[model samples]
Target: MAVLTSWVWLLAGCLSAAVAEDSNVSALYPPLWEESPEQISDYRLEDGKHIMDPWVITDRMGMYRILLKQTAPYFASYAPENEQNILWGLPLQFGWQYTTGRLADPTGMTDCGYEAGDTLCVSVDSWWADVNYYLSVLPFLAAVDSGILGIPSDQISILPPLKDQMMFCYTVSGCQSAFPEAMGRWSAFFQYMQSPSSDFDGLLEYLWAAHTSSLEYPTRAFVDRYAYYSDQEANFEKNWAIAVDYIAATRLPTTLSRVHSFQNGLPPRVLVDTDIAPYIADFTPLQNKVLVLLNVLGNIHHFTGSLFLTAWESAMSTKAARKLFLISFEKFLETSS
Candidate 1:
């Protein structure tokens, strides 16, 4: 069975309340966002080929960092300091998953992602890591196909995770064959990236198309994986999945800084039954409410399908309006329920 992972995210790629900065926040980014070598010189050479292993969080993140560094020139005309590089969203989201322990083995039967075991290990047992593979490897291989990596496709080899090794494609041709739609969409993004006519909005459109496709395809495959997670976590995953469609429709910038900022409004770790809005002192009231609303929306039988996008776009088109709507929504839920 070619299964999937139950990755979760909420309020990403959209407007959200302000984030509370952590005291040890710098400790949260992936292992080497700042120091990871951007060039090919650092990769292990095997039989004259650069070996890439993404099963571990650090190495997987390194690929995105390297891609961002390599693609910086293409985006310089749009924004400064690689801020506009569409690839930034990939690593930033992955970093959050790492800090929040989403990349760890959720089952508790294994220490795959624990500091006491292999801290960098991205467990196959983790739904977040599994879904992330599509986001990571597909875009990565597409980058190589688009010639953004500046390396021959055959010159590099990607090592698979410890388990579910057969589920993913390792080479450019393999990925293209297995996931043509996502690979093609991502290839278009990179191609447009190098085009002289490329603009920020256009790049974002392409990026989001590919981003949502990557997410949507694996969701059905991983429906069975939800059994391993807590109800709160599973609900959050479904809610996050639903929310991304609306965000993609809006074509949000999805830059590194913007995503990093928006993600702070989300819960940093797996949600437990005890964690509830206005009751959890660690998170702001707004964050708590946002979390609560996501669960409500995800769990509500009446809120099925993609119908909300029409209303969401018409009524909450502006950031202030969306924020106000979400803030007011909790009250509505209170009154109605």
Candidate 2:
């Protein structure tokens, strides 16, 4: 039920990097996260005019401005050798985002254990959500294009999240260790689905060169990969149908429509923005937001089924058929390490 607006971002330091930041791309990051004008006077002039040195960022009410004004960006600048970005008690809180009407307001879903603003986790059934994942990846890709990730455009896949190949079910920690069993199975399944061949070498090159990225820096990889797969208008619907049938007949529940709204859900993929100017050339804000929202919901449905399969603890045998519930979730490590 949440909407994702544009997510591109840039990385310039405090007041010092103003010229370098502005001279580069304007489309990659949100206004608050990018370089900006020095709005106030830094000195007095002999000609009766005041000299101005504007602030570098625009998030006057958000963390960028407020935090930088009070302190420097890096902990290295701290007077005490061991200090971090904590004012009062919050240590580097990203600007406010609460699930209720306001950014930090409580949702009162403690009974359901659903906290607003805490990332929503859903288990999806038979649905296609690459579109959603692509939306999440765009911002990171933008950063990469902007030269922030320090990799040649061709070498970006050497980046963390995509380097080791596998079927990643969700963003729990780093994908492989987080859901080893599920990723193991999904990786095998995707291989079976694609059967990488000489004919599909284009896809392989795209994946190795572009589709993959480090979760630590997945933004650029996502933008290119998403555009590649979805834009090609590949046979995604047919493949998803096959996934639905496999789940329905041999897996849990009867069909892919059985979605889980609570307890588990799809998560957004994170990325960095290094390259963004060219993308802004083709940017269409209204359409992009709508696409991201649709992807988020669809991913939720698909992930729920995967969670149920991984969470299936025991075998079932009964005169009236069988059922498996997460009877003792404590048996498994519930939190992502």
Tens digit per residue, CA lDDT, model 1, 1-337: 0110001123321244223333453443444587555666678889988888888776788788778888889988766566667677788888888888888888888888898998888888778888898999899889987887888888888998777787778999998888888999999988988888988767877998999889866776777667778887887777877767666755666665556666766787777767766577877655676677666555542454545555555544565554554454344434433
Error of 1 at 140 (Å): 0.7
Per-residue C-alpha lDDT of model 2 across residues 76-109, encoded as one tens digit per residue: 3322321222221111112111111112112233
* Best by the TM-score measure: 1
Q: Give the TM-score of candidate 2.
A: 0.18
User: In model 1, where do residues sit more than 4 Å from their true spots?
Assistant: 1-14, 17-31, 299-302, 310-337
Estimate candidate 1's RMSD in Å.
Answer: 7.1
